[model samples]
Target: MLRFIMQFVIILATLAAGNALSSVFHLPIPGSILGMFLLLLGLLTGVVKLRWVEGVANSHLRHMTLLFIPPVVGLLLNWGAVHIQLWKVLLVLSLSSLCILLGTGYSVELYEKRKRRRNG
Candidate 1:
């Protein structure tokens, strides 16, 4: 319980700091994204150890679907908006999924071939 609360506070503080920095610099990107980038940098630099908040963050992230349920339900309540963009959305989704699948498959194949060459 304490861990969860601490994680939530840390996330909020990071976001607030990111927002402050963005406002100070007049950056065009969103505060949350900037915060995420900052968090990533901190992790890479060992300034923020993964074990420090990994458990809490992972737990929250694992149940992130629950957080989206209300928004999804609200969207369903306004089904007309979805209908208007259905075709365009579907086309984009299909194309993006195809690209991801192809890229992942090619990457795995390349990795396997390289591994085999190294071993042989």
Candidate 2:
């Protein structure tokens, strides 16, 4: 329990620092995003060990779907506004999805090819 609390605190501190940096720099991006980048940098640099926050992160991931519920509900509530732009929204979403799918597929194929070449 104590370790969990400590890990949670670390996460919150990182977010707060990110928020502060965003505000201080008048950044267009959200502070939460900046905080995430900071956390990633820390992990990559080995300044923040994965074991320190892995449990808390996994717990959040487990319930991640629940986090989207509120935003989805909000969107549904404003469906009248969204309905007018439904076609445009659908087109953008479809195109973006396709782009992401193709990009990921190409990347995986490249990675596999490289791996196979190294092994052989």
Candidate 3:
């Protein structure tokens, strides 16, 4: 219980720091995004141990879909505005998804080839 509380406090502190940075710089991006980037940097630099927050993060991930419900409902309720640019939105989404798929496929193939070369 104490560990969970400590991890939660650490996450909140990181978020608060990110919020402060966004507000100070008048950044267009949200504080949560900044906090996420900060957390990523910490992990990559080995400043933050994954074990410290992994449990809580995974618990949140299990209910991740629930988090999208509010935004989805809001979008549905304001469908009039969304419908006006529906085609444009669909076009962007389709193109982006296609790009992501192709990019991921190419990346995986390259990784596999490199691994095979190293092993052989």
Best by lDDT: 2
Full-model lDDT, candidate 2: 0.96
Q: Which pairs clash (backbone N, Cα, C closer than 3 Å) in model 1? A: none
lDDT of each: 0.87, 0.96, 0.93
Model 2 lDDT at residue 58: 91
> Per-residue lDDT for 3-115 in model 2, tens only?
99999999999999999999999999999999999999999999999999999999988999999999999989998776467688899999999999999999999999999
Tell me each candidate's TM-score: 0.70, 0.73, 0.66
> How well is each residue in 1-120 modelled by candidate 1, as lDDT tens digits?
887788778777878989988999999998888999888888999988787778878888899899989998998898876656678989999999999999999999999999999999
Q: Write the per-residue lDDT of candidate 3 for residues 61-102, one digit (tens) a residue.
A: 899999999999998999878646768889999999999999
RMSD of each: 3.2, 3.4, 3.8
Error of 1 at 82 (Å): 4.8
* Model 1 regions more than 4 Å off: 81-85, 103-120
Candidates arranged by lDDT, highest first: 2, 3, 1
Model 2 stretches astray by more than 4 angstroms: 81-83, 100-120
The per-candidate count of clashes, in order, stands at 0, 0, 0
Which residue segments of model 3 deviate by more than 4 Å? 80-82, 85-88, 99-120
